[model samples]
Target: MPLSEYEQRVLEQMERQLSSDDPRLANTLKHRGRRSVGRYVAAGLGAVVGLLMLVFGTAESMPVLGVIGFVVMFAAVAFAFANPHSHEGPQGVVEEDGTVRPAGPGASAKGARAPRSGKQPKAHKPGFMDRLEERWDHRREDGR
Candidate 1:
């Protein structure tokens, strides 16, 4: 079904707005929805190879090779599903917590993200081994 003239105009306006907001992301998205035939072909080929390896390993009673084949199969499936090109670009600010956010014109010059919470990270206490070491040091100091 074809979109009406009004709908078309609205869609075009939205596209223009998106491109203006973030041109880099817009370009990445404009190419495609990020899925390609080449990716599927690679994954399929990997799966086939892994299956053959697994069968051969089982026939030969090589458990290690079988395990490796399983791992390869798992890796191929993971590669197929994974999106390597996420929207996060070089200009995005990576927060301490690992979240990427777009940088605005008035973004911080220092590039250091200020903690949102007023409380700072607490100082860690020494573990049991450290306490034992401290005790040993104290005994040596007293003997000296």
Candidate 2:
């Protein structure tokens, strides 16, 4: 169920309070939603280059080059995956009882946003599956 306007305001206020109280904790709570495609592409290319280098080195009887290629590939893959901004969710944010809540609505989950313009972005309409789920939930709530 969607939050009422008052509930949403309260949540926003709490978030703001949390941020003010512990900026570090608030920053840590924020999720980095997704990574760019370029990172994956570079990693793939690096792997392919490494494989080609390994094959060529073997054919030409060069062990040193093969080792270098392997190192390069490993470094590239590590660099791509080790980015701090790639993390998601609320794994570190702990409650008073040592429980973590999944980042919910209004939670600071930063990712790519559409460029701002004079016009507001169109709201997404619920799909057939979503409507069906809503109906099912309503029925369950009514003790059907």
Candidate 3:
């Protein structure tokens, strides 16, 4: 879930304080958001392969194959989740004011910066739940 405005402010305040107090630690914490499409694809493929292995192993009465399949599936999921966000971004590090700075010295800083989002966009557009929530929020705002 996304943080509320108040919560977000508090978090940013905390970050600013941290950066001020410990530059090294703040630098360590500065990172890009995770959104790896390739990793997701690999994980999905691995899961399917694992499932086939599991089914065949069981049918063929090979406990080892079943175990391997289970391992592969587990590993695939683990691998997917373990992967972090790509480091490549126009904004390499966030500043004390929460604005992003150019990732590299070579990157141009002439244009206005794009707004950053906490969450990455998904392959599919917003689904039913998202629309329902939007409507609900609108109704609440309208005091209906």
Candidate 4:
């Protein structure tokens, strides 16, 4: 069912909070709205335009122009298919009990990774962020 205006506003508020708190997590969980009838209309119109171009260009022996028009029409259909509505809910949240819960509409356990209990292992390899931070830290220490 379509959401009521009040419900939509509540959702928007919650989303704004999450996005502000952790942009990376919010991006991972982002949901664009569903493709509507308007998109179908646009696809139909694009097909009609492509058909006209093919008919006219073929008559003038302009095969390349006709191909270009057909490509545009295909792109329009591809766009419609790509814009699916997200049934996905929020991302996982850390609970007060020191457990992680998946961010469904209602809270649910999605299991957690076992906490590491042994002595810290040496780094196998440093990642790009690690290298960058290391470089900056070194530069600061050198008063550069």
Best by TM-score: 1
**Segments of candidate 4 deviating more than 4 angstroms:** 1-34, 84-144
Q: Candidate 3, which ten residues in sequence have the lowest lDDT sum?
A: 106-115
* Residue-by-residue lDDT tens digits, candidate 4, 1-144: 999999999999978877765566675466344347788888888878887887777889999988987887787777666644223234566533344456643433434343456858545565445778999999999995
* Model 3 / residue 55 / CA error / Å: 2.0
State, as a TM-score between 0 and 1, how close model 4 is to the true structure: 0.35
lDDT of 3 by residue, 1-144 (tens): 999999999999988877766666676567433445787899999999999999999999999999999999999999887735233445575543355656655443433344456856546655445778999999999995
What is the number of residue pairs that collide in model 3? 1
**How many angstroms is residue 76 displaced in model 2 relative to the true structure, after the best TM-score fit?**
1.1
For candidate 1, lDDT tens digit of each residue in 30-87? 7555577788789888888888889989999998888888888888888887765434
TM-score-sorted candidate list, best first: 1, 3, 2, 4
Clashing pairs in 4: none
Evaluate all candidate structures by whole-model CA lDDT and list the values in order.
Answer: 0.73, 0.70, 0.73, 0.67
- The C-alpha TM-scores of every prediction are 0.47, 0.40, 0.44, 0.35
Q: Per-residue lDDT for 36-122 in model 2, tens only?
A: 677789888998898888888888999998988888789778867865433443563344334554554435454324446687776
